[model samples]
Target: MLDFLKPPVLTIQEFFILAGRTIRSIPRRPHYLNDLLMQMDIIGVGSLPIVLLTGFFSGVVMGLQMSRALQTYGAVSQTGPIVAITLVREMGPVLTAVAAAGRNSSGIASELGSMKVTEQIDAMRALGTDPILKLVKPRFLATSFMLPCLTAIADFVGMIGGYIIAIGLLHLTSAEYWNGAYRALEYDDLAQGLIKPFIFGMVVSLVGCFYGLRTTGGTQGVGRATTQAVVVAIVWIFALNALITKIFVSR
Candidate 1:
């Protein structure tokens, strides 16, 4: 009985020790830098179109809804500023992070878990290659870099979407819309929104990689890890969003 208990405790300690070793090993591996670049392309570049589409539709919907609401008070002219401010301050980072979690978390978990199940990760260990440094560190770094870029793209596209809706659907002139939007928009809103996605990216990547590395058993374990990764990533994103909002907005 003591032996069994000791194994579990030892395993837990080993996991943390491995994680720390992995972190320290990152700078020594050049392959991880290459992998990190590839991951950035996959996680950031490949996901751009979807993020843009989502941002566009969200902006259109927000404009339509806000326009209707403001019309009742004869403030329809405020639509541009309202849509721009809301998108920059709230919708862009939040939506981009949610979309990224959906796209990347499950994929990361499944890929890493499959590698583990196939013993490829074990092979790397046998070869004296640190799997965590080669795999997880690159992914974490890639996510940290890419998520902010994705959010910036999303913010631009979302603003364009609002522009289209205001000009086409609401009969607002382009100049009028741009003018009001520029007047109300501040660098602070963009900075605030842009900062959140970087943190969200780190959270999503770390959780996904952590769960992936923890997978055991067989194919069923991989499936379970993938599902858990997405669920946990989303939950953490939302919780972090609230915490960040409170920190930034509670002023």
Candidate 2:
């Protein structure tokens, strides 16, 4: 009767166990800096184009939408500030993380899942090399470091997109738009913007690795793991965003 619940319960338990071990392993020796750098290139550099496009179009769309809404109140001039705040506080981090979850999470799962199914992971274990140390650590560190950088880039590019709409369509001055956008950000806003992506990065990488490491059933299981990694990472990203936002708002 409760068979359906067993998989989920077991998954949750194993996820925490993996997370705990990853965290503990951070301080231990046998650092794989080379692997970390390679992952940074893959996770950070490879994600640039998608992140750029997502940020730009999001800002453009936000400006268009907010313009109409604000025009009703004769506050169309405030579009820059509104766009800046919205992107920095919510859209930039969330969207970037989602893009990353979609791209990198699935990739991680597929790669690791393939390794597991083909017995590469088993081979590593037999050779006394910890798969978690070589694989998970690099990805986890890379994502955590790169996500905030990506969010910042996204935020800036988004502001530029909003600027185009503001100046070109709304007829606002450059000074007004830039000033409003710049002044709207406080330390708290900046903190939240960076913090959210960092946390989301950790979750994304870990979720991908978790599903990857547990993969079974050969090639079919690899596909399944890839799909699940993306879906689960996204769901957790949104959930964590809400919780973190609530905490920030309460303060």
Candidate 3:
């Protein structure tokens, strides 16, 4: 029991150390603006298509499923508000973060793990450049900046998907669906939607960087780090989502 606790505790300590150094380096010299932009493009723009696809399908499914339930009370026409609130308050941010965790986390881990195994990180340190500064900082900043944007896009696309089902399948008028959706959202719901993604972005990026930097055993270690990064990032995303939602709901 104690042995198991030791590994986790040690890992947690190291993770926070990496996180601290990354944050501390942010305002320091030798800023990697180009790398930051590249990561933004990679983690942000590259994630757009998948985010759109998932958001749309999630809304479509929600509309279809909820209609069946609403039929019992003859409230099927209320599908827009239901879908909008669900997506904006919960589904959009969670799904978007999970997707980014799968995509960006694995990429970050694999890329950094490879660099670690090949001695590139070591070489950088030898050359007096900080790996945390050059590599981790940009990725962290980019993911934190972009995940919220992706979540917002996903929420909009999901609403559109809900609209399609409302008009096309449910035979509801466009005004009914759009108006219901627009009105259902409040400032609190919007705030919850945005905050979850920002926290998730930090968790995902930092977890990836942590596992990647600690990788060993050459190629096999890289593979292992990549897998761990995805799994851990996803787990943290779900766990954090639950915790955050609980706090918001309590308020």
Candidate 4:
């Protein structure tokens, strides 16, 4: 029982320690620019299609749903602002993180887990190289930046989707919808949207790397880590969102 209880606390501590070390190594000598770029290509460019599709569909649904709700008060033109706010403030970043967690997070865990099982990670250690720097740092940097980029793409695409539904389907004037969207979206709101995904990106990569490094029990452990990484990262995303939202709202 103590062993089981210990992992919950121990793992968190280990993860943060690993993060702190990796972050500190960044400005030191022997920076992995090439590796970081490669990871970015994989994490950012590779994720574009999924993010675009997610944004489009989410916006369409939001516009449609909000249209119905707003129509009750003859406020259909407000759909644009509503959809924009929802996607920009909450849904876009959160959903992008969710998609990334499902795709990149699991992939990171599985890739690291396989490397661990194959003893390749051990080989790197024998060569006097830090695996966290060589491996985790690249992924960490990639996810931290790319996730926000992906979220931005998704937010733009989602707004287009909202436009289609609001202007095309609801017969609302394009100028009215877009103007309302522009009016409702303040600098603070947009800034928050931009910031959330970056934070979530780090969360996903860190959790993935953390669980991945802890893999044992052969292939089974790898699978376990991959699943746990996704679940834990997602839970943290929502929890963080709540905390961040509270801060935003209270101000």
Model 3: lowest-lDDT 10 consecutive positions: 1-10
Name model 4 segments beyond 4 Å from true: 1-4
Ranking by lDDT: 2, 3, 4, 1
Top candidate when judged by lDDT against the true structure: 2
> Per-prediction TM-score, please?
0.88, 0.98, 0.98, 0.97
Clashing pairs in 1: none
Comparing 1 and 2 by lDDT, which wins?
2
lDDT tens digits, residue span 1-251, model 3: 47878988999899999989988988998999999999999999999999999999999999889878988999988998999999988999999999999999999999999999999999999999989999999999999999999999999999888888888888999999988888888999999999999999999899989999999999999999999999999999999999999999898
Q: List the residue pairs that clash in candidate 3.
A: none
TM-score sort, best first: 2, 3, 4, 1
- Residues 211-237 of candidate 2 have per-residue lDDT tens digits of 999999999999999999999999999
* Stretches of candidate 3 exceeding 4 Å from the true structure: none
Query: Candidate 4, residues 37-86: lDDT per residue as tens digits?
Result: 99999899999989999999999999989988998999888898898899
lDDT of model number 4: 0.91
In model 4, the number of clashes is: 0
Residue 214 lDDT in candidate 1: 81
